[model samples]
Structure formats: structure tokens, C-alpha cells
Target: MRHDASRRRFLTIALVTAATAPIALRAASAEAAAPAALPKLPATDAAAKALAYTENAAAVKHAAFKAGSSCTNCNFFKGAKGQAYGPCTLFPKNTVAAKGWCSAWAKKL
Candidate 1:
């Protein structure tokens, strides 16, 4: 009877360890794969500005930030080819156009 109890306890511990082993490994892998630094945005030269979305009147200005373009048309928009963010001369520091807006929008020039 004592042997049976010992075996049951061992099995319980082993089962718990087995279940948690995968979880621990997964967490380690995820942390390892995590980016070392903040992800970068695309370049903003003349070529990047070609995809700007501010020309569309329907596009709204970025909230909170009074100077940058909105995500819809900003040069850094991350949507589809047309829907993605484009480059803007306004926000030189921020790669994603998800920030501010301005009237200086050019037609890719």
C-alpha cells in the first residue's frame, strides 16, 4: 500500500512537470525570438514619398499630434500598398505615419 502511494505521488509530479516543460520552453523561445530593439520603419526619400496618402481629402489628421499626418495616408502607414503608411517630410523621426499631419503634402515629389 505504501508503494502504491509513493508511485501515485511520483506520477503526479511527473505529469505536472511534463505539462509545464513545454510551456517553459515556449516562453524561453519567445523571449529569444523577441526583437532586440524597436522595429524600424521604411526609408523616407523621394521614392518612399511616392506612396503618401494625404492627397485624398477623405484622410483625416492624426489625433493628439497636431503636426504629423494620420495613419491612413502617412508615409509610414503599414496597411496594404495603397492603404499602408507612406513617407512624409513632416515626421522625420517617426517611421510610421501613424502620428501627425500637415498641409505640406506633396504628390510624391
Candidate 2:
């Protein structure tokens, strides 16, 4: 009886661990998959300068700049609607102002 009780306890522990292991791993992976916060891009940044980036689209001096073109409508923009700033594919690890404009801007489909 004693040996049977110990075996049952061990089997119970093993089953519980097996059942929960995947759940625990999934939780850990979800945390790891979370995106790190991106920093706002500065207008004076070298990349920004090369792209003629302006925080305000209306202030852009590039000849190709459209009157209504802005980061919020750009293909590269990854920010949520109404946000002040968000990530851009052109400037990894940095975010652009929603109202900003750059030479690399492509109309979002």
C-alpha cells in the first residue's frame, strides 16, 4: 500500500507538470515576443536629414513632398491612429511623428 501511494503521488506530479509545461512555455514566449518600445526619431538625425524628414509635413522643403503626405499615411508607419508618434520601417528602433514627412514616404495602400 505504501509503495502504491508513493507511485501514485509521483505519477500525479509528473502529469501535472506535463500538463502545465506547455502553458508556462507559451506565457514565457508571449513575453519574449512583445516588442520593445521605440524611441522618437530626431529631425537632426543623419538618416532623417538624408530623407529630409520634418516633424511637420507642411514644413518639408522637398520638391516631391505632396501637400497632404504625412507619416500617418505612409507605408512605413507602424503607429496606431491618433498617436503623436510611432515606429517607421525606414528608421528601425526609432519612431517618427505622425505629422512628419520624409522623402522615403510611400502612400499606404
Candidate 3:
């Protein structure tokens, strides 16, 4: 009709920009391959020496340290309560220190 409706609206905008250009270049290469922070947990790693991890919960002396246990109140701290460092479902991809301590400290219920 009008040159076949302008060639079917330019082939439906070139088939929706070739079906969304590989999901917008894979979401901009996953936000430029993430990792801008996460990287602290290093008290000699190996799972921070099998959970004796201490970034200074009053310099833990073990015995499953308790007097006000840390990692910003444990339960595998994910950070935010006055964060001095964060993430720690037991150091996945690092970051811990909010006055850390480990022996898998729980009690964040």
C-alpha cells in the first residue's frame, strides 16, 4: 500500500533489533564482570584455617568464642549493621571483618 507500509515498518525494527541484541550484550557483560569489592576474608584462608577465623572479635582465643561474638552478630553475616566489611555465608567470594570471628558463630536469629 504505501510501499507495503514502509516495508512492514522496516521489518519490525529489524526484528526487534535482532531480538534484543543478545540481551543487550548480556546485560553489558554482567555489569562489566562484577567484583568491584568482595575480597577481604584472608586470615590465611583454607576456610580461614577451618573456621578459627579472627579479624578481631576481641582477638578470639577460640573455645568457640562467645563474650559478644562477632561478624556483626553472626548467623553467617551478610553485612549492613554498621558495616565495616560484609558478605560471609562463610566467606563465599570473601569480605568479612565487621569485627570478625568464626567457629561458625550462629545466633543471629
Candidate 4:
């Protein structure tokens, strides 16, 4: 009787844990499988040409960051360190820089 009781108790716990394990795995996988977002910049290579700059770095192919700036200090930027590109009221998509820049620019005070 004692052996049977122990076995039953262990089985109950195992079943419960097994059922919950999938839920936990799904949550973890959702986070792990998520792709890291790209950093946004003030302007793309083409967009930079429209801006007024005596030295449009992107225009001359001398841009400091054609596509590598972070979101901490971009014109359309709206975030802090480690955060993905925050939504830009200026642009259609949520984008910012991670060490990037262009001609069409403005420093958010």
C-alpha cells in the first residue's frame, strides 16, 4: 500500500508538471525566437540627398553611419540604451539609430 501511494503521488506531480512545462516553454520560445530589431536613422541613403547640408555625408558616400546608428540619439529617435527603435512621429515605422546618421537630421533636445 505504501509503495502504491508513493507511486501515485509521484505520477500526479509528474503529470501536472508535464502539462505546465509546455506553457512555460512556449513563453520562453516566444521571447527567444523574437528577432532583434534594426536601428533607425534620421534618413536613408536616398533621403539624405533631399536635406539641406553643406556636407551631406551620406550624399557624398562619406556618411558616418549609412545604416548602423542606435536609437539613443537620432532625429526621429525616442528611446534609451538597449531599447529597440521607438515609434517615430515623423516616420511611418518605428525606427532610430545605433551609431547612424544622415543629412535630413535634427538633434532631439
Say which candidate scores most in TM-score.
2
lDDT of each model, Cα atoms only? 0.49, 0.93, 0.88, 0.53
lDDT of 3 by residue, 1-109 (tens): 8999999999999999999999999999999998778888887889899988988899788897889989898888988989899998867898989897889899888
Q: Between prediction 2 and prediction 4, which has the larger TM-score?
A: 2
Q: lDDT for model 3, on a 0 to 1 scale?
A: 0.88
Candidate 4 per-residue C-alpha lDDT over 14-101 given as tens digits, one digit per residue, 9 for 90 to 100: 9999999999999999999985764453444344345322222333444544443333455665556675445444444435433434
For each predicted model, how many residue pairs clash, with residues at least 3 apart or on different chains? 15, 0, 1, 10
lDDT of 3 at 29: 100
* Per-residue accuracy of model 2 over 26-65 as CA lDDT, tens digit each: 9999999998888889877999999999899987778889
> TM-scores, in order shown?
0.47, 0.75, 0.35, 0.42
Model 3, residue 23: C-alpha shift (Å) = 4.6
| C-alpha RMSD by candidate, in order | 9.9, 3.3, 8.8, 7.9
**Residue 29 displacement (Å), model 1:** 0.5
Model 2: runs farther than 4 Å from truth?
A: 1-20
The total of clashing pairs for model 4 equals 10
Q: Clashes in candidate 1: how many?
A: 15
Q: Please identify model 1 stretches exceeding 4 Å from their true place.
A: 39-43, 53-69, 72-95, 100-109
Residues 28-67, model 1: lDDT tens digits: 9999997443232444445335434233334544343333
